[model samples]
Target: MNFFIKLQDKISEFKLQINYMKKFPKIVFIGSTNFSLFSLKELYMKQYNIVGVITSPDNPIHKNEKYFSPVKKYALENNIPFLQPGNLLDDTFLKNLKAWNADIQIVVSFKILPKKVWDLPKMGSFNLHASLLPQYRGAAPINWVIINGENKTGLTTFFIEEKIDSGKILFQKEIEIGKEETAGELEYKLKKMSGSMIIKTLEKIMKKQIKPIDQKNINSLKYAPKISTKNCRIQWDDPSIESIYNKIRGLSPHPAAWTLLFFHKKKFVRFKIFVVKKILKKHSIPIGLIFNISSSEMRISVKEGFISIIEGQIEGKKRMNIKNLINGIKIRKNLFVR
Candidate 1:
């Protein structure tokens, strides 16, 4: 009897949500990654009137093979109409997008939109950025924040404009960054926290309760450009040990921080370091040289400290813990890293 009563209560709550969402304007969603999927799922669960979805074309995985994006897969499962346009400016694509007759659009983790598309909706479009606006205003904001050893970061919603991430702010929420948080872990936390914030933004916009703040008023802006291969390389001689620690965790699990392992100053192989501990101790060994190697651990000397490898991967081997990596490979003391 208790289970049945709880079930009925849940059903009633769901109905209430549906009734509340009836007043929401017709919404069109644009996104391509897992971060975008979280927002889309929240809106759908609240029974919002999602008119259509816009995502990138299927990505090629191998020759003659392609895979659907996370957003596209969700849209397919829920029977939501979606458009995969190769070019956002294509005539047919624009025509179909316009036909959706969206009252407003919400963009997250997607490409830059041309003005024509952003201006099509009667109510205007807004984008959700992963960082506090006027700072970290570019791709890979999450990664950059952790990489730079920032202790505080936040999310922002702003109107879409010609300049990327420079529009008027709709809403902002500050969040704390854990000292040991990796980029992937922080992203997960923020994505989960975004659902309620998105719902509130839509509610405020519909009620005309928002006073958008121009980003120009904010100062001390820092940019987060797209991370490149060059940026992921680890330099052992970097003066700051904290910087090295931050770099390893910032790029953890994806495009990780890497270095070259030179064995006896002859043959060299690449290594991707996934996890490490920074030990700040005075060391006489040369920087980037492997000072100690045990069956269960590996340590390399750096300026003013040592980097203890907890988890890592060789060029052609799968990721492994230090013990397993040691057992699999012959890591001699003379084998230095660069």
Candidate 2:
């Protein structure tokens, strides 16, 4: 009887080990930006079995300065395995990644993965895009949405495909855009939302409860190409004061909307505008004309109305509000923005 009892105990222990092994799937994370860092931290807190992280290599910040990607920094602090492959298709990198035996891969704010890499995982790879899929599908979704004066935006988790951001959707969560919100402010909110949404998505995927929807079925698609220097140049001649305000807010705090300022007819300078307030009353002033200059305020006329320049930075000068900006600079009554 003693021998028989020992034999049954050993069988029970083996079964327990197998069950514990099946409890969590091996997951690999790929990302480089702050958004990726937020999602990675959340997954780590949930005690997910994150096998590895893939991020961009550190870039030179300036003379003798270097900046590492957010994901890389987090992985080092936590002792997580990470790779910063310059070439994703390199054979050694592929072999090492394949050896990890990851069940699924998750990407956020990372470079586009090649087919060979994305297809390595058994359960497949998925990406967390900031905007609703099939819309704002490009490099700078957050900025584009606000630049276009969109009142609503959201996050989308979709399976990876050959085409960029053209994957089938798995989950999404929408949020309202505040009228006065800047791209930087909206980014903070979306980052938090993305972390929670990603966790829920992983759970559903583990339970096999999600149905991937094709992006083609979605209507009213709009593309959000990357923002360029030309795109950031403010066109004061544009007919709408509200639209100009939106543009300023959308690009504020980073790669800000810019315009030309002429102190004298021959002395022109570049100014980056960060914040502006719209004056709804109609103005007969010619477009691009500057007027109503006070010690602490400056107004510029647009096609249909005027805009108060609340905050800006003159070229080669520190950023300041209208009050401090005009403190030493002479303002001509007839001065107009070019």
Candidate 3:
């Protein structure tokens, strides 16, 4: 009897939402590549009538003809219309979207939009950036925060305006970053947190219960640009203990902190280090000292202490026990990871 009652209640709620959808503003979501996929999935579960999905064109991958559009795939699977605008500012692009009479738009991990496209949404569009607005606002928030060794960072949802990531914050939530948190881990946490937060903000907007706060002190803003393979390498000559350790943790695991080692002064291989800890010792050892303690743990000397690299791999080689690596490679003494 209780199950039947609950089922009926859910069906009634579904009918109410579907009815409400006809009167509700049409929402067009932009940018559905990464975490945005989850945001769209959540919105669909809420019975939001997404009129269309606007995203970048599908590009070829793997081979010349193999192509994929992440947003288009998701939209097709959910039975929603999709638009892949090669140039967003094109006049025809404007004409097509305005025809939908969308209520508002949502952007997550998208390219910059021109004024013509942004103004199409009647209720005004909004975005959910990974970092706290007015700070760490750029292409790579997660990497920069971890590289700079920040103790805490947060997510911010804001009403999109003229400037990029410089809009009035609608709602913000902070997440305390663990000291050992890598860029990949931080990204995972922030994506999940921000996705739910975006849904909450949208619900509030629908109910007209939100209080917008102006972004102040724009001068304090810092940019976190995209990272390159060049900056991922470990530099032991760096004297600052914390900075070096921070870099090691920031890039470890995926895009691991690497360094170039001279094998027989002829070949160079990039190797990532892990299980790093600074130990104070009196042994007068120079930098890049490879100390073999066991088959599992090999302590490499840094400026302060031995940076224990328990696991790593050379190029085009299998990642195995450190002992196997040392034995296989015949890593000799006096060799430096320059």
Candidate 4:
């Protein structure tokens, strides 16, 4: 009786393995950043057939210091095949990619793919974009949405096309932006949600449950161009407290909203504001004036209000809260920000 029971258990385990192998299509994942790792992990944990991976080449952050992309590291640890092609249109890269014979490809947080690469898979390729279709369509959608004071944004999965982010949409899921959420915070939220969305998209595609739809009336859509140093500068003269608030948070913890500190026409230093709270009330002081510099608080006067610096970093110092930052700086009456 014991022998027969063990045999039955072995049979069940074999059947499970067989089902896992037969159900999922062959996949070749393409991604680079930590944002892309979430979806790849989900697919891996679900026992999907990952045939290959394509990611950006190792890039040097400092002289003679190069690091592997998140996707490449994962592929290496799992003993899965991978390629890091500098040019997507390279003939040798194309040959190796075609040899994988993937049933489908999934792109997440990766560079633009040429038509040849995107059209290679039998079931074609789909991309998991960070924003909903026909809106926030560009390189920095997550940052732009928050900077524009938008209360809602979401994710979209679409088929790859020649045009950037203009392909037929496969699925979309909307999320409400928090009242005081920073871009980094919102990105973290969306990153966690993206894993499940990628899985659902793949299942629906495998089951023939999705009907791709073309984007409509995109001529008037808002764009999310890459953030530049000029764009990150804090425009203190802007009348709206909300606009300045949004701009600061939208670029927080990365390409942060910055301002030049001045001590009576002498350039003092530059500071990057990360977290802030707006105080709205009637005020006669000139905008960009730094007042209330105390051991416990630091406030910058703005239009009809003051922007209380909750967290910030000096140009050459580490990030600190308002209290710590204030404690380190010398109290001066003539200090102001531009």
In terms of TM-score, the best-performing candidate is 4
Candidate 2 lDDT by residue in tens digits, 185-235:
999999989888888888899889999999875577888888899999988
TM-scores for the candidates: 0.92, 0.90, 0.86, 0.93
Backbone clash pairs for candidate 4 read none
Looking at model 1, the pairs that clash are none
How well does candidate 1 match the true structure in TM-score terms?
0.92
lDDT by residue (1-338, candidate 1, tens digit) is: 99999999999998887776765698999999999999999999878999899998998999999999999999999999999999989999999999989999999999899998998988899999999888899999999999999998889999898888888999999999999898989999899978787888889999999999998654677788888989999988999988999999999978899999885338888999999998999978889987678887688898979999999998889999999988876547578888
| Minimal lDDT window, size 10, model 2 | 16-25
- Per-residue lDDT of model 4, residues 124-216, tens digit only: 999999998889888889999999999999999999999999999999999999989999999999999999999999989988999999988
Ranking by lDDT: 4, 1, 2, 3
- Greater TM-score among 2 and 3 belongs to 2
State residue 75's C-alpha deviation in candidate 3, in Å: 2.0
Give residue 69's error in model 3 in angstroms.
4.7
Roughly what TM-score does model 4 have, to 2 decimal places? 0.93
| Best of the two (1, 4) by TM-score | 4
Global Cα RMSD, each model? 4.1, 4.8, 3.5, 2.8
In model 4, the Cα lDDT at residue 190 comes to: 93
Q: Per-model C-alpha lDDT, please?
A: 0.90, 0.89, 0.78, 0.91
Clashes of 2: 0
Error in Å for residue 107 of model 3: 0.8
